[model samples]
Target: MQTPRPKTRRTFIKNAALGLTAASVLPRTFAKESPQPDMSLSYQDLPQWRGFNFLDFFVPNPAHARVKTPEEHFKWMRDWGFDFVRIPMAYPYFLDIDYSKDITPEEVYKFSEEKIAHVDRIVEAANKYGLHVSLNLHRAPGYCINAGFQEPYNLWKDQDALDAFCHHWELWAKRYKGISPDLISFDLLNEPSLREDMNDQHGKREAVPAETYHRVAKAAVDRIRSIAPNHLIVADGNSGGHVAVPELADLKIGQSCRGYWPFNISHHKAPWVYKDPTGLPPPKWPDGPEANREALIKFYQPWFDLKESGVGVHCGECGCYKETPHDVFLSWFGDVLSVLAERGIGFGLWEMTGDFGFLNSGRSDVDYEDWYGYKLDRKLLNLLQSV
Candidate 1:
């Protein structure tokens, strides 16, 4: 992945910009009552399961297939208070295929046993550590938000794509059939947004029409239950996990929400979201140029209502990039966590050990803790543990 290139930025200009930038912060209770992030949530309305995401298949290719997480991380997670781990996958990464050319639909169904054994190892090891594992397909059969390859069909509009989507889930349902639901769950897709095409990394993505989304989600859910009746399943919210999909509420599955509200802050200088974050005002806590806690409260009301309506809710992904000021990021994230916790919701940080993770975050201002060879962000870790 390309390193984020956030330009040297200033806070909203001092004099002229001061008056317009101030916004009320959430109550101090927001941070004091921190919520834990988890993916074992929103499924079967289980207790909030706390943990972090591991991005082995996030942007995999033939050369870097199956970058498994260190087993010690699972041991450490168990040592810590967290009880969950979400592993986002790229479907192609586990398949037997020739990467030199576009993959045929026939090849999509093919799996490589050696590559799949690594997944078995991960799930079994995490379970042994007593962490509930949520395996999600960040890159699916025919669509991906940060897509890298071209697919022959469109997931939202084509039967073939939906077939392959359900087939992959069916494969998992069989592999881990009869496992206790408390130990494992399958998040249907990373974030479902209707795109004009399958391969454009930067393309306009509107919500999949409610009917279309229901059809796709139900189809996948049906297939999973057919083989493994007790497999827990969670579907992401429509339009990049920001809005709840009423069409799916009847499906009796958990739904996910994102923590990147007031995008200017959570994704501060993220290149995939911002082509250039140069000269943009650095985000400020409580109220930045784009939003405040009031906005955040209003933004998640729909999700809260959905949870009230009996759909399990979880923040599948949340965290600031290394670019945001550490203090500012912490204050805002504290509110985000607290608010979700108040609603009995769970969350998952974007990752465990990368730019957005607990170790080697590359944040220049952090006071590092030398935990073995890892540059541990004890402040962030403490904040997460505070909830």
Candidate 2:
């Protein structure tokens, strides 16, 4: 249900310009016009459903798992106007086997049972809330995008690591066989890196090649489908949402599609990756909506047309860091919502609470209030509902 590309780039450019002006500057007609599209699909097809990440499984214990029950989380999301949640998990975290550095065969079997149970809990919770979920392997058995995790495992070279990775997916497929299609999908991996000794051959730290990623991604997809034929599989784009278009153009998979999240906004001011930290400011809420719309268009246009005939394209993650001003965050989100409404793309935020989340992950019950206070960002939520 993808909307046809805007009438022309010129129309988009003009509308985009108007969008940048203060919301009041724009003619009331634009806002009054019905936000609904001619076609209908779940929030997944509405473009505005782009949402937040629920990263309890990846971050280490205490911090990783959200204290709020899935029911509480989903209810908050619904009230906040989000349509989906992206959950990232590490293979080793749930498994009994210590896939941490070195592991034995017996440990692998033990880990398998644990991993299965954990995934089942997540899927069941997501379904309970009527929210779509994307399960991503944030840290594979041996590899991770971050160097800290990569050193000990040497995941790329270890054969055992790769086998454990494959085995985990096979188990996951079997465990969630009957999960509802609307409630969940599988993301093969988080950000897959292509660094040689922590740096790419180009000397630039980039994601692994599309071919290598696709190879493993396909394997996982095949295995998962064998067990749960209906689960939608999502493949991530290479480095920073830069899809190797040609590489993906030739790839064909049934009941599966690909997704991407360029780091421009969400990772802005992120200390872990960005050196300056302050260079990329969080999006401003007061910024005119059109300016935000153009940014969204600029970021997504390159990969927009990549949606295959039957497959869908989802912007799996996007959000400004919590450090960014709340107004800035709201402005950016408003613009994103407008464009997504027009384009009908699916999306999710980087996190729910914590560093980049909507809720304060540090507190037990939305305790620490930002300038925005305990109340959710109502303006942004209203705009999302409008879309």
Best by lDDT: 1
lDDT (Cα) of model 2: 0.54
How far residue 364's Cα lies from its native spot in candidate 1, in Å, is 0.9
lDDT of 1 by residue, 178-199 (tens): 4566778889998889888657
Global lDDT of each model? 0.78, 0.54
CA lDDT of 21 in candidate 1? Answer: 17
Error of 1 at 51 (Å): 0.8
Question: Could you say which candidate leads in TM-score?
Answer: 1
Give each prediction's root-mean-square deviation over alpha carbons: 16.2, 16.9
Residue-by-residue lDDT tens digits, candidate 2, 151-232: 3344455555555566667666554544555566677766565666542223344766666666666667677767766556
